[model samples]
Target: MTTDGFTTCLWFDGQAEEAAHYYVSVFKNSSVGRVSHYTEGAMQPAGTVLTVEFTANGHKFVALNGGPQFKFTEAISFQVFCDNQEEIDYYWTKLTEGGGEPGPCGWLKDRFGVSWQIIPERLDEMISDPDTAKSSRAMQAMLKMHKLDIAALEKAYAGE
Candidate 1:
């Protein structure tokens, strides 16, 4: 892993700790990391969690109780490359439990309002197929879906 990895910092109004824990529980290979606290008088409300680092599915994220000046949007999204339909379905189901909204092209917003794309591995291949017609069909099929159906994309590619 020569590429240096960086964590995405999330600014939560008052739920940094709760969000960190929730994310840790959702992903495999995840764990809560160093939790730094604000020393007395350091923050407006002292004793708050200044930063809580957590890793989910091997990706690092830091949640900070940084007030409500900013919020998340769909412009940036985490893409989960799932090898099979089972993995895709599992993530899609788990992430949408609270207020997560399922969108077209395998995209969803978790309860935390963070965007995620649960994509099938084969879908990329199909979209890149040498045959333009096959690729077009697969692309068209993907555009109509919420949680992407791998089988449907395959069927579209096969002209079914």
Candidate 2:
């Protein structure tokens, strides 16, 4: 509760603690914060974890151990913007471990069904280039990618 801002709350089926641990381990400058348990709830038993506050690269989040009444979709996601391919590869590999699935344009769904966008900062530089032709080529290249190859995007922007 040190930092003051909006915290994103994630719903999970009794895996909030585990997810918090996993996420803090993946992102830099992250850690788990306060943990609260329920006293009497229809979903989970008393004494079970109700909410866990955590952080990822300075962004705050709260995970709730809600029941299976809800499920995660692609409507919302946490984006990890990397400056280079190495950082991008590190996040991509770690988040996709276990039962994760890869999606096009640097998108991936983790084991917990949470969507993540592992994008390189250069992607924007290329896609937003002043030259319309170069930007269009970069967009086309990005549309065909999974993990997002920064080198390929640069190549497309250069029209080579």
Candidate 3:
């Protein structure tokens, strides 16, 4: 109904502010916006951060200090489509640093437990090719990699 785009809300246990700043630092064209604090009689202490508004890579997000009841899982993840190996490597390294866990097929959990997919922009085209053989090779190659290698995937797609 409304023309306003959606804003993704991330829940954290007393880390809303910290996460907001961290995300801003990691992304280009990003900055921290409004920060709301809890008031008297709130679940959290007065003056404690309740939510932090931030923009990362031009996407609106709100980080909420919603306590420890909720945790990030792999079921939901953010995908970063990269133009080349360098872009993939940059995102993978930055996201996986500081205790982030690398998963299969370019999936990884950052230090804050947020799952991310650092994938090449062309990966979808390769994996979804009409030719089964080429697509299968690319899929197999991707399955074996933690951080995606664009050249390797391309080679596989070409049956090289």
Candidate 4:
């Protein structure tokens, strides 16, 4: 067996190549890698795309054209930690474009139905603070917003 580290595999219904390219375009340190095609006696057409290996934000992934038997659900989501509101907004906008739906509390489903959580890096610190009042306020602020706002969360944490 290969001793490779964990690589996430995303199941797609004949959209493996498209998803791989889209993910690579959205991320900074990303690139599309090797692509595998179906062979004779395979479940799909012999020349059809089987899997597309890619690296998005330095994370390895494989987009598989595994048919419509499987679909992505909110049960599994990718969390993008941002240093500031600009980063959060950028990711939120890009991920929510082209038929993507925005959910509550920084959660959104991309065009391909993949869920993502764009959150501020400081959110954990604010929510986990020893002061219950501050943490509670921060949590309240977060609950009301779709895309996370760092400034608002800070203000709430400070009781301002």
Tell me the number of clashing residue pairs for each predicted model.
0, 0, 0, 0
Ranking by TM-score: 3, 4, 2, 1
lDDT of each: 0.87, 0.92, 0.94, 0.94
Q: Rank the candidates by lDDT, best first.
A: 4, 3, 2, 1
lDDT of 1 at 127: 96
In Å, residue 38's CA in model 4 sits off its true spot by 0.7
Q: Between 3 and 4, whose lDDT is larger?
A: 4
* Candidate 4 pairs with clashing backbones: none
lDDT of 2 by residue, 14-130 (tens): 999999999999988999999999888555688999999999888899999988999999999888899999998998999999899999899999999999999998788788889
Score every model by TM-score: 0.92, 0.95, 0.97, 0.97
**What's the C-alpha lDDT at position 160 in model 2?**
94
Clashes counted in candidate 3 amount to: 0
Off by over 4 Å in 3: 1-3
Comparing 1 with 4 on TM-score, the higher-scoring candidate is 4
TM-score attained by model 2: 0.95
For model 3, which pairs clash? Answer: none
